[model samples]
Target: MEKRVHRPTAWHVTHWSSDPFSLGAYSALLPGGTPQHRTALGQVLHERLVIAGEACNAGAPAMTHGAWNDGLRAAEAALSAGARKVIVIGAGCAGLAAAQRLRAEGIDCTVLEARGRTGGRTHTVELGGVKADEGAAWLQHFAENPLAAVALQHGLACIETDFSCPLAAASDGDLPDVDAAWIALTKRLDRRLTLAEAINRYMVTLEPAHARATQFAIDANLVLEACLPVERLSVSALDEEGVGYGDRMLPGGYSELVDLLAKRLDIRLNTPVMRIDWSSTGVKVNDEVCDFCICTVPVGVLKALHFTPALPETQQQALAHLGMGKLEKVILQFDGRWWPYSRSGYLRWYDQPASWGEWLDLTDAVGKPTIAGLIAADAIERQFSGRTDEQIAMAATEALQAWAAAIRPTP
Candidate 1:
């Protein structure tokens, strides 16, 4: 904390307070579950009410692009159901995407957003005259992600980032190597085993040193990538559904993509939907009657909404099974760059048990002295959640200083 260079000149947190739909960042998949659970959560009720968002996407749940794709699917479903006028709720990426697709198809639809802006969780803000994405920053699997196409179409520049971090290289001592065992186990894992169980079983067979290193790598990977601890994650689900290796960042921030999607769309801002009444005849959103309605609100917000006659018991149970994961970032802008700039965009520290160890170096991309410290995992997020902004910033400052000191201790 006494390090002068590590101290941040300015900082900002995108808590998404005004938008209830983005309660956290996005929804998290539970163990032994498929995206089918998410799709089922988006089931159309009575042929009048349709649910759409990243939560409803079976392919890429909890992603901005997934939300956009889900919007298109919902719009198509509404049109196929012979809907004349459709009402889309929550003007985030999902709502805006649905409205844009509906307009393209010559379908009459209106987008009602609770906030006075678009992009939902994808908010871009200026810090020290440089733009940074507060939420939904990366385009994972850019070649396959639909958002990449939109970015390319709009002439937005994207910088590919490699998030791979080797713990062996970072660790001072010679750690045990579990690469062979890990590869062998991953090649043929028991579908019945949870990620934690699988990892524990593998660790028990390894040497004590190797086991410790293996455990650290597994735990860090799960907490850093999935935003969940190993126990809550499914090994089979992860093995079957691999997170693509490639990721890219929008140098101009994600709001640019949102801006592109918002053009020529009927988006009504600051109009929050209080209640919904749906039946075979039609659906009414806040007393506004429409042939069909698409609810793109976040799962947290959706659960709180009042439904006329209430949702089915099965649907209610499905909703209860789904839960949100907490993930926050502490972005610090320094007077000068202290961290080494390299092709590897991420830095991981295993010193603290869930502090802001993983950081994204934005110096190269933003052309500024900024580093965003990612605080993932339930325990870590909860710890930071209870602290004030000043406290969190101080903790981050200490962590960064420690990281720098460890990497290159002063004489």
Candidate 2:
């Protein structure tokens, strides 16, 4: 077995949770929250002010496609109400989509983005020499995802990723069974419970050995998929979300779709709208006033923006109930492929249970020597608390080397 640790040629890390414009990676429901909160946020106020984004998209919250669809819906609502001039806030997928719809219908629309760049959470950057998504990368539930059709339309190659396969470093036990146990527990719940509370209840029913394995198995997907830590996630939240086996990725990066949506649209980047003052007659976003305003900012960062007259009671409650997901990523580019090219397309390193749970191999997917490691749940807190980007890279590197040493050791 190779004892030497291989350092990366280049590395990139994401701190979505700390970004002032984002606050977190994605949207989720808190312990006492429900889908009705998302519905309430999507409701238009005064027939001239509309709010749209993934958080407002109950059918497919936390996905870019959901944001796109909601953006379109918001624009349609404003147009149907005879809106002429419009302001769409946040130049992410939702903002761009809403602007695109308005422009097509000949409604004068302008998009204001807080950052210098567009794409919101769907950022794409270089992780070595390869083009990769710094934020979202997957077209989850691809069979039903609009991104699949959009990718094909744009001539971008979409590859299916089967998550069931894993190049495990001695898995504790059948993970799916443990996953089933979680699903079963959700059904018999008599009251609202945080994920952490429910897990403790389940742990008492198992032997010490089995309990450890169960912990490893459940932790594998809990925060990694939901993006929220156990304490923040509601047990009932899973019941509202859609789960399926179909998944796909865009090798050219998700920004390609964003570009297509943003084409010919008037977007003012780096221009943050600090305050939104709206009335029954018109809407004022900062100094610019318009017939209507569509705010597509992430729910996590909404509280920072001042709204004159305050939002409706329902919107306020929804904001309080919704949560931001804590998932972060560390994409490393190596001189060569040091890890085993497993049929699973991913790895589960049980040896480094706490820090490293799952990793996606992108060598085959992106045709480069790259691997993407996830930071979620408590790992986001433990690993990123006071670490620099270099330090974060180092920590993730240590976990990666441990996996390589065990699975594809050099002779």
Candidate 3:
């Protein structure tokens, strides 16, 4: 790549894939979700109730912009008939944005949030003396993210991160020394990714029927081996979306974006909406009757909550059909760097010899002690599930030592 242009001097990285609240970073469609599910999920109920999320926008779903677009479309739908009253649940990116837009369009809207603070999965926490994004970090498709423009309008800072850096091996010590083979595998994966982008672009021009079927096929091929399949994904949802390009890091913290959106909105913290009575013209929330209601809770939470009057069997089935991805990010602050031969700022340790799973260095944060994090949702769940923090840490240290030996770099 240097042959084509000058390389940058610095970079940053993060691992939100494993956060408990997030389970996995963003929403992903599984093998069971059909177009009918997404369509049903978003279908306006008697011009009254509408669901919107990254999950709603099949094409751009699981992205910040997708959430924004969903909110806007929902608001537009609500206001089309000059509806005067509206209620929005969840104060995260989607809910807040929906309220703001509805307010702008002269529709009366209120934002309700279950957490004490807004920004559901998008959260920032203090770690090692610096504010870090504990949840969603990357601001994807910046050019289209209304939140990005909002960030700029508010003078919030943003940083760019490159995605082509080398990935480290996570295989266990006993696993055959497949570093070279793994590198080749990584290159092959990159090529396949490029191919996917081109094909997706081409998919845009095809007829809806053709495009939907093709996308389902492509998703099936791309779904991770151990994870859910893509045939369950909603093809109709991906049809109307356009490609988004700008991707950047929120230097201050992505959670701050959620906070910014939450300002001036009516939010109730720790007030998880346990049930929704949607059987009548007005929905009931914990015995309170409201003119309208919008639920932006994660599907997981929604699936667990008891619904009064019960959802339509089809809707319940749709909820049951969707799958949640599991990811875990375990951060360990070290007194100093360990690995030698630092060609790349980030390192990847894979196919671990021990039970700790894959590890990586969070080498480029703004502050101290050279923090590194390990991630392997399945492994973490298997070895550390219900185990004490000490057990998890000890397991991690052993894994790190093995990774150090793999590169054979001076401590």
Give the number of the best model, judged by lDDT: 2
Backbone-clash count (model 2): 0
Give residue 101's error in model 3 in angstroms.
1.1
lDDT of 1 by residue, 73-182 (tens): 88888878888899999888888888988898888989898888888878888889888888888887778888898898878989887765432223344434435544
State each model's C-alpha RMSD to the native. Answer: 3.0, 2.4, 9.9
Candidate achieving higher lDDT, 2 or 3? 2
lDDT of 2 by residue, 255-350 (tens): 888887788999999998899999548999999889999999998788788998799999999899898888888998888887778775778766
Candidate 3: tens digits of C-alpha lDDT, residues 335-403: 555554344334545442224333334445545433334343244455566766555655566566656
A best-first ranking of the candidates according to their lDDT comes to 2, 1, 3
Q: Return the number of clashes found in candidate 1.
A: 0
Candidate rank order under TM-score: 2, 1, 3
Task: Tell me the whole-model lDDT of each prediction, alpha carbons only.
Answer: 0.74, 0.81, 0.56
Candidate 1 TM-score to native? 0.89
Candidate 3 has an lDDT of 0.56
Cα RMSD for predicted model 3? 9.9
Model 3: weakest 10-residue lDDT segment is 3-12
Question: Each model's TM-score?
Answer: 0.89, 0.93, 0.72
Check candidate 1 and list the clashing pairs. Answer: none
